[model samples]
Target: MQILEIFGIAVALSIDAMVVALCWGAVQPTIKASHILKFSLVFAAFQALMPTLGWFAGGALYSLISAWDHWVAFLLLFFVAVSMIREAFEKGDDNEECECRSMGSDIAWGKLSMLAVATSLDALAVGFSFAMVKTPIAMPAIVIGVVCAILTALSMLAARVLSEKAARHSKKLSLLGAAVLLLIGLRILFEHGVFA
Candidate 1:
């Protein structure tokens, strides 16, 4: 594949990660630099790793993985969305001061890992496609990882700016983020023909 084609595919695959990062930024009480760096690294790693696995696994595991990948992604995203929604409602004090501490307490590593996997499932399938076409995986995987990292970081930063600007409406923003996540999950299901 040409470099442009690979970059196009990388951008397409990174959409989920970008959206998820935005949601995470929107719902967080405060977004620290560590959170952004951690999220970008983890997401980029998964985005790179999944495609490589898919390419290696190839047709041998295609049937099995394709059968339920969408469902798994949907479930993981749904869980995060529900958590965001619950957190939005659970906050009793709108005017409460936020400590702006590390996000470790707010977002557990397990959840972050799940989100990473959830967002990268499509990239896994893309890897399988590349294998089928005999396309080189190295360049594409690197492009996908780099693009996803850049886009996710940008999305988080954009959300942080918006969140700060509308600090008084944090609850509404959280709910909106949760709703967007739910829609993304549903869209994934629909794309997989789960609803058909």
Candidate 2:
């Protein structure tokens, strides 16, 4: 529940949002500040909301599983890290293929919402982990939301700023992000004294 720990978790949880926003940035004919703002807001909202929802759900089950809360937290993070790594290696769709290049992608509310939901699923699990560990959800949720928003915006800007470089390194970045998550998960286990 330390601030640094929460921040680490937030960063780990935001990787998906960042990648998605990066794709959006690349596909648009021209990137704008407003577009970045919109993507960040939508992605951040879902990332924040999912955790709060998970926290509530986890709260209901806390007393029933208090003894193994740390284990659950560690497991949740490990699973999320694994999932991210898996996705990074998965086959790319045409949209995914052109992630760091300009392509005509229609931006709509439904698509944005779906993307938001898809990217925030890990945050939902993270929220559950927070609840299990008795971590206060408010501060952590805020950190996650803010970090996700910033990362999403940055990814978009970075994509546009260095489209060619991004195109070449996007997968490597994703892999690095997943590795960070894996480390964060291990850190959580260590911090909880679960592996000591």
**Among all candidates shown, the one with the greatest TM-score:** 2
Candidate 1: segments with Cα more than 4 A from true spot: 59-105, 161-196
lDDT by residue for model 1 (1-196), tens = 5676577667656655765676568767777888888889889999999989878876565466666656755665576567657766775465543333343436777888888998787567667655644567898899989988998888788876653444445566567756665665676678668779
- How many clashes would you count in candidate 2? 0
TM-score of 1: 0.59
Candidate 2 per-residue lDDT over residues 71-142, each given as its tens digit: 887788778878877776673532344443332455677778888999899888888988987888999889
* Alpha-carbon local distance difference test for all models: 0.70, 0.78
Where does model 2 exceed 4 Å of error?
A: 91-96, 99-106, 191-193
Q: Give me the candidate number with maximum lDDT.
A: 2
User: Quick one: RMSD of model 2?
Assistant: 3.0
Model 1, backbone clash pairs (residues 3+ apart or across chains), number: 0
**Residue 164 of model 1, lDDT score:** 42
